[model samples]
Target: MSVADIKKHLYKAIEEIDDEAFLQAVYTIISSKMGPGATYELSADQLQILEDRREKYLKGEGKSYTWDEVKDRIRKKDGL
Candidate 1:
């Protein structure tokens, strides 16, 4: 199905919904993710962790892996 078709179907389904609470929940989730003014605020601890990681990366102390290597690790961990 195309993106346009899925959006039309969703619109029609949402139009048929009568429960205000369920609609509000759906609206909250969609607005939080895609609304015009939507922005995520990270906590101080999260910011500090990111800064530490950046410092390590700049100092060549952080390890990095290729996408295929990461996928292989995940597959091995999952016994796939």
Candidate 2:
């Protein structure tokens, strides 16, 4: 039902597994973006840095571009 519940279920299931195929299946689930959410809390300094990044980004001073323009520029710069 909840993420924690799913995680407990997953761990229990994984602990019972012996097959390579089963392990791969669990690996696929774990690596998926929609699967488990990362469990971490930032330090105060890290949070401040993330907030500073947001402030900088909102100022349009990060890297201005449309998708293709940015891609092409990067390609040219790298002589790709």
What TM-scores do the predictions have?
Answer: 0.52, 0.35
lDDT of 2 by residue, 1-80 (tens): 99999989988988988999979876776678555556356899999988888888899767557999999999999999
If candidate 2 were superposed on the true structure by all CA atoms, what would the RMSD be? 10.6
**Which residue pairs overlap in candidate 1's backbone?**
none
lDDT of 1 by residue, 1-80 (tens): 99999999989999999999999998888888796657567899999999999999999999988999999999999999
Q: Show where candidate 2 strays beyond 4 Å.
A: 34-80
Instruction: Estimate every model's Cα lDDT from 0 to 1.
Output: 0.92, 0.83
Best by lDDT: 1
Lowest-lDDT window of 10 residues in candidate 1? Answer: 32-41
